[model samples]
Target: MPKDTILVVDDSPTEQRLVAAALSLQGYRVITAADGEEAIEKAAKELPRLIVLDVVMPKKNGFQVCRQLKTTAATQNIKVLLLTSKSQDSDKFWGMKQGADAYMTKPFTDGDLVANITKLI
Candidate 1:
């Protein structure tokens, strides 16, 4: 099988690196973007199998990006998994409403991240 890729999108460098490191160690290729615009750019170019997006970001934000991706034929098939500090059910609902395939809260276990990605990718 072909290798799978994940795009980690977060304005926080620490969060981006943490997710990338954890996912990379699990044998997946990890790409990163600092914010929503960058996430869109990278997703268009890289065509990653999945995206780990953060909710609160400068510029377009994760939900907006997810919507754009889902609506765009070129990028619509790429799965989006929202990774954010937003813990409320409303947040999860909005994430899904915006086309995210999954929603995971911040400080999530590496096992959860890996497992979700495993299922999606």
Candidate 2:
């Protein structure tokens, strides 16, 4: 069977690498985008099983990307996991409203990240 592909989007290189490494360690095929525009393009083209998106980014934010993805026919079905430092309840609410399958904050454990992705895919 093919390994599940996950797109990890974050503006910070360290954060992106860390997330990618964790997912890769768990046998996932990981791709990455440094900002939201690239993320949108990759999502439409790659159709990854899930997107790990960061809320604050140049070109666009996670909410904007998520909203666009959810509304666009080609990418609408792709699951999105908002992985951001935004921990406010309102931020979580907005993420869900934008059609995220799950919202996870930064400074998270690899175990929690894997568990969330497991539940989603």
Candidate 3:
């Protein structure tokens, strides 16, 4: 069976690499975007099974990206998992309000990441 494709979006190269590595280890095909604009473009073109999106980024933030993805017909069905350092209750609420399928904070374990991806996909 073909592995599921997941788009990992984050401004930090380190974060991107970490997330991508974790997903790849789980047998998922991983694509990456450095910023929100790239993320939106990639998500629209690649139509990955899920997107692990960071909330803080240049050009546009994760909330903006998620809102756009959820509203746009081409990308609306793509599941978005917001991953960021913003762990406040309000941030979680806003992320969900923007149409994220799941919200996970940074400093997460690889197991937790896989678990969330497994559940989302």
Candidate 4:
């Protein structure tokens, strides 16, 4: 059984809960952050195996946070999976540039989300 922890970061409470619950059902320990700053703080403290991040958010946005986490040695190894409604090609490009291990657009199914998480974690 995989016991790795995952951090879900999103501004929408509804989205956050959906992601959290799905991962929890898969037996991965789940934690959540409502925005970028909190996400960064929790990622540092928890050292989770993966981080499910949202692009549009207050405080710091997912790309910025991903860059910060990737550049820092302590958190660089933590896999970052960018999940967002921003489906532009440029958005995907920039997400990869910022060190996102994977990018999945919003309106994703629970199975797809779990598949991505499993791949990353």
Summed backbone clashes in each candidate are 0, 0, 0, 0
Model 1 per-residue lDDT tens digits across residues 13-103: 9999999999888878888999899999999999999999999999998999999999999999999999999999999999999999999
Better of 3 and 4 by TM-score: 3
> Tens digit of lDDT per residue, candidate 3, span 13-98?
99999999988888889999999999999998999999999999999999999999999999999999999999999999999999
Candidate lDDT scores, in order, read: 0.93, 0.96, 0.95, 0.96
Model 2 error, position 37 (Å): 0.5
| Candidate 4: worst-modelled 10 consecutive residues by lDDT | 112-121
* Model 3 worst lDDT run, 10 consecutive residues: 1-10
> TM-score per candidate, in order?
0.96, 0.98, 0.98, 0.97
Predict model 4's lDDT versus the native.
0.96
User: Which residue runs of candidate 3 sit more than 4 Å off their true CA positions?
Assistant: none
Tens-digit per-residue lDDT, 35-54, candidate 4: 99999999999999999999
Residue pairs with backbone atoms closer than 3 Å in model 4 (clashes):
none
Q: Which candidate order results from sorting by lDDT in descending order?
A: 2, 4, 3, 1
Task: List the candidate 2 regions with Cα displacement exceeding 4 Å.
Answer: none
